[model samples]
Each structure stands twice: as C-alpha cells, then as structure tokens.
Target: MPKRYIVEVDGVPPSPSPISNAVVVGNQCWISGQLSVGDDGAYVPGSAREEASRAFAHVFRIAEAAGFSRSDIVYVDLAFIDLADVKEVNGLFGELFPEGRRPARTVYQAAKLPFGGRIKVQAVAPR
Candidate 1:
C-alpha cells in the first residue's frame, strides 16, 4: 500500500482551544476554519465583509502552501455567528471569485467559534 501522507499547518491564530489550521491527505488538502487573521497574524476589527475578505486571503495562503490554488478549490464550508452577515460574506465572495468560478459552498449560522471569531471558512482543494 502506498503511504498516505498527512500535512498540517498551525500557529495561524491564538486559538483559545486546540485545532489544526489545515490537513492534507493524499491528493486533497483540507483547510480548517479560517478567520480574519492577516499575514501578520493579527485579527483586525471591521464589518463581517472586511473580515471575510481577510479570512479568504488567509485561506488562500494555506492552499498555496499545500501546493494548490484557489481555482483548484472543490468545496468550502462556512460559518457565521449571525445570519445578518450573510450579505456581507456573499459580497466578499463575489470580489474573491470575480471570474465566476467558485467552489461548492455551504454556509450556516453557528453559535460560536474558537477565539471569538465571527466567521470561519473551511476549504478543500485538489493537490
């Protein structure tokens, strides 16, 4: 049997709890829930719109590190603490995928997230 390799990326944020930022198995890379952590690893305060953009950017970084691109994303799971931010996340989604190609997505309202994050996004990309 071929050895299936698993990859992990951590230290993306100061999660009050333990979690993996991403995990790669075989030819697929699974990114964990991404919040609004910037390249400097700081969470900026703003509307969910701005936060989602930053979160997506952070997600792409993890994808890149896993040797994948945004175009190769196959699925995404999103969470929001409030439904009112749906429009904001949708608008940011438009800006992120202006080419009209987006991965299969599922978004839901959650009661809470690690580190008090308002939104989190998980992604799966071909590796």
Candidate 2:
C-alpha cells in the first residue's frame, strides 16, 4: 500500500481544527486552503497582496514538505474577500510562477473569510 504522509509548514502553528495542512498520497499532494496567519498565530496585517503572498507561501511550504518542487505544482485555487484584489494578487502570481511555469489557477470571491483575512489560497501538486 502507498504510504500517506501529513505535511505541515515549519514555524507555523498546527490548525485549530482536525484538518491537516496537507496530505501526500503516493506522488500527489492535496493542500488545504491557507490564510496569512503568521508565526505569531495572528492574521497578518497588510494589503491584500501581502496577505495573499503569505498564504501562497504556506501552500508552497506544504508542497515542499511533501517532496514537490515549486514547478511540480500543477494547480492552485484562490479565494478573496474582495474581487478588487484580484489584479494585485495576479501581479504577485505572475512573479511567483512566471510564463510557462505557471500552474493552472482558479479564483473566487468569498463573502467572508476566517480571521477576517483578505485572501485564502490552496495548491495541488502531483508527480
């Protein structure tokens, strides 16, 4: 049987709920939605782009912990409290992935987010 591994970001607190930050099954990893909760265990205070950056950082951290490289990530999903932040987040996204190396992306607007966060992000990587 293929082993299952739980992946967590170093320096980040475990979730208050039962959910794993991410899980690896064989060559694939499924990452849970992440908010910009910093090492201090508080939602980061900043612009939408800044918060989104930290959230995406969590996603990548979990991916790496699961033995997947940045380029190995195949898909990402993003949720924003306001659609106005999409352009800013897109700029950061372009910088992170760049051209042909970009992962498949889906974006949505949320009526509300936990911790009153501005953004939430998740990723998937399969090898």
Candidate 3:
C-alpha cells in the first residue's frame, strides 16, 4: 500500500472540524473542501464571487503545501448554495486554469454549506 501523508499550509487556519486540509499518497494530493474562511477563522462576508475566490485561494494554498500548483490540478469539485453563483465561480475558474489547462470540474447546488459560505471547493492534484 502507498504511504499516506497529511498536509497543511502554514498561513491557513485550521478547520473547526477534525479534518486534515489535504492528504498525499503516492503521487496524488487530495485537498479537502475549502470555505471562504480567513486565516483568523472568520467566514468572509461578500458576494458569491468574493467567497468563491477565497475558497479557491485556500485550495491553491493546500496544493502548494503538497508541492503542486493550480495547473497541476486534475479535478475540481465545487458546491454552491445558489446555482446562479456558478457564473461568478466559473470566471474565477477560468482565470485560475486558463483555456487549455482547465481541470475536469463538477459543480453542484448544495443545500447548505459550513460557515454560511456561498461556495466550497475541493481539488485533486498531482504531487
């Protein structure tokens, strides 16, 4: 079996729940869902676009901790409380991944999210 390792970024705040921010096994890194919480553990208040941006920033932070970049991401899973927020989220996604390098993504309308966040994002990346 491949060894598994837990990964955490320095500047990111710990989750209130018991969860590793990310985990690495073999050549793959699995990042946990990230909300729009700040390093101070406060949920940032803003529009869907702002919240989504913050969540993605946390995802990138975890990816970096696992020795990967956003471009190295192979898949992304997003949960949004409002389906209409997808347009805003997609803009950020495009900015992060660009045209030809976008990762496979799945977006869903979640019934609710932790911390009253509008969006949550999780990613898988090559380590």
Q: What would the TM-scores of all predictions be?
A: 0.82, 0.93, 0.96
Task: Give the per-residue lDDT digits (tens) of candidate 2, residues 2-91.
Answer: 878888777665677789889898888999998999887688768988998898888888888788888988899999989999999999
* Candidate 3 lDDT, 1-127, residue by residue in tens: 9989999788888899999999999899999999999889889979988988888899998899889998999999999999998997788788888989999989899998998888989999985
**Candidate 1 or 2, higher lDDT?**
2
Candidate structures ordered by TM-score, highest first: 3, 2, 1
Query: Model 3, poorest ten-residue lDDT window?
Result: 88-97
CA error at residue 4 for candidate 3, angstroms: 1.1
Error of 1 at 108 (Å): 0.5
Looking at model 1, residue 30 earns an lDDT score of 82
Residue 15 displacement (Å), model 2: 1.5
Q: CA lDDT, every prediction?
A: 0.76, 0.87, 0.90
Order candidates by lDDT, high to low.
3, 2, 1
Candidate 1 pairs with clashing backbones: none
Scored against the true structure, residue 104 in model 2 reaches a CA lDDT of 96
lDDT of 1 by residue, 8-113 (tens): 5453554444655667777888887778765465667678988787778778877887788988888888899898999878888876776657788998999987
